[model samples]
Target chain A: MLSCREVTLLLSESLEHPLKLRERMALKIHLAMCDGCHSFEKQMFSLRGVAKQYVNGLADELIKCEDELPPPPL
Target chain B: MKINLEKSTKTTSEFLHDGEVVEDLRRQMLKFATQQLGDFHLAEDAVQDALIGALKNVTSFGGRAALKTWVFAILKNKIADVLRSKQKTVNVSSLQGAGEEDENEDFMSLFDQKGGWNHDDRPSQWCDPEASLSQKDFWIVFEACLDHLPPKQARIFMMREFIELETDEICEAADITINLLFVTLYRARMRLRECMDMNWYQRSQNHAELS
Candidate 1:
């Protein structure tokens, strides 16, 4: 049984990738019994989505500017 | 002998033409450096220095790495040199004053009141991912929040998260051990989260209520 603190750390990493099968099963079971952890997962998911969107937009702006830049001095 | 001399001159001219190549590389490097350094002046200076050094030693570029990668490596060194020089000039006491008192107190109080990670009861309704991203206000707050991070952590986080570099490359470029890299990234994310939640999201919510 992972405590909320342990689960919180794992939640962030897991959102970045899939957890192992056992870890996934454990998290699912815990979420079934724990509303707090469930809500925490939802918040983490939303936060990750927001961060990715914001950062991706910034990356696009940089890429666009890089494309428009003139060739370097000889 | 004249023909040989002419051939040698042509080679030299080609090398000078490579200077143009170096400039293109610098522009690409500047994009990364500006995002990493968060200071346009520093990024510009670093890019300039890297270009001069690359031109002076153009023959050394043996095509091992892509030209962009090699230029980025040089800019990374320039950034490190600037940080080292700045570090030496700072007084220890002044360093302590940097983000130490008021911000830490505010953050601690907020954590205590909110009951740490366990009590994150803020609603799941987030800024519209597509809409907020296109707004200039979002960029303003985003850049401000990023600039507020401690320098080393900010560099690593920006490289890893914003530039989408590999973890191994970030560790190598930043010259940090894996554990230190992870710790820095965690701290960066936590601070950004706190700042965004406090500065941007709450104010937007307040404006919404009033309107």
Candidate 2:
């Protein structure tokens, strides 16, 4: 049996990408029964969304820089 | 199979003609390098160096990873070289060693024994990246918090979370295992969370006093 700590770590990973079906089922079952873990999952999803936005913003700046660059020498 | 030199040359020329491919790759490399070095100039230099090297050795590419990933891998090597050159000039003895550990420990404690954020009462809120940049104070504090992260963790977090690279691609480029990636990312998030929370609290206090 995974401790809450182990489960929480896995929960974070799951938010980043798809988990194996078995792993997903395990997390789902645990979250279904555990309020704390469920809340943790929600928080992880929220954090992921925020982080994605942060990166997208930086990426946009880099893209803008690329647009401003001169065309390569002929 | 007989080698077709003419066909090979034609294919190579056709590949080179795909300007969009090169632009996409350059953008990705610039973003990855910038996030890793935390300096725009250094990142630009690293990307240029990597591109030159790539052009020189384009024949060696086996087409295993995506072109963007390959360019990023080269940029990582270039950044490492840059770091090595810079490391030679820094005096290690002048730095406070114990203070670093204390800071790391303080960050680790924010996660309870269960490895979850200690504060469960407050719900995490999602913010738009483009919108957040409009608030200059948020960007300043966010950038400051980013600076506080250990280099590797900061790079991984920025690449994975910010740049939105796939985990496997990051693992391949950074040459780190999946588990290390997760742990580093977790630590990075914990530190940033603490930094943001503290900044928000201070801002709130200031507003209260002004009122």
Could you say which candidate leads in lDDT? Answer: 2
DockQ of 2: 0.14
Q: What lDDT, from 0 to 1, does candidate 1 have?
A: 0.53
Number of clashing residue pairs, candidate 1: 0
Candidate 2: CAPRI quality band: incorrect
lDDT of 1 by residue, B1-211 (tens): 3455332233322443675755565676777567666567778888889877766766633342334445555666776555445444312232332232223422333233333433553323334433323345554565677778776566666665644565665555555565555556556665666565566555644322211
| Residue ranges of candidate 1 with Cα displaced over 4 Å | A15-18, A32-74, B1-32, B35-42, B45-123, B127-134, B204-211
lDDT tens readout by residue for model 1, A11-54: 65563356799888887887787666675576555444444444
Model 2 bad stretches (over 4 Å)? A1-3, A33-36, A58-74, B1-33, B38-42, B45-134, B201-203, B207-211
Listed in order, each prediction's TM-score against the native is 0.49, 0.50
Residues forming the 10-long window of minimal summed lDDT in candidate 1 chain B: B89-98
Question: All models, DockQ values?
Answer: 0.12, 0.14
* Count of residue pairs whose backbone atoms collide, per candidate: 0, 1
Clashing pairs in 1: none
lDDT of 2 by residue, A42-68 (tens): 556645655544433322321111011
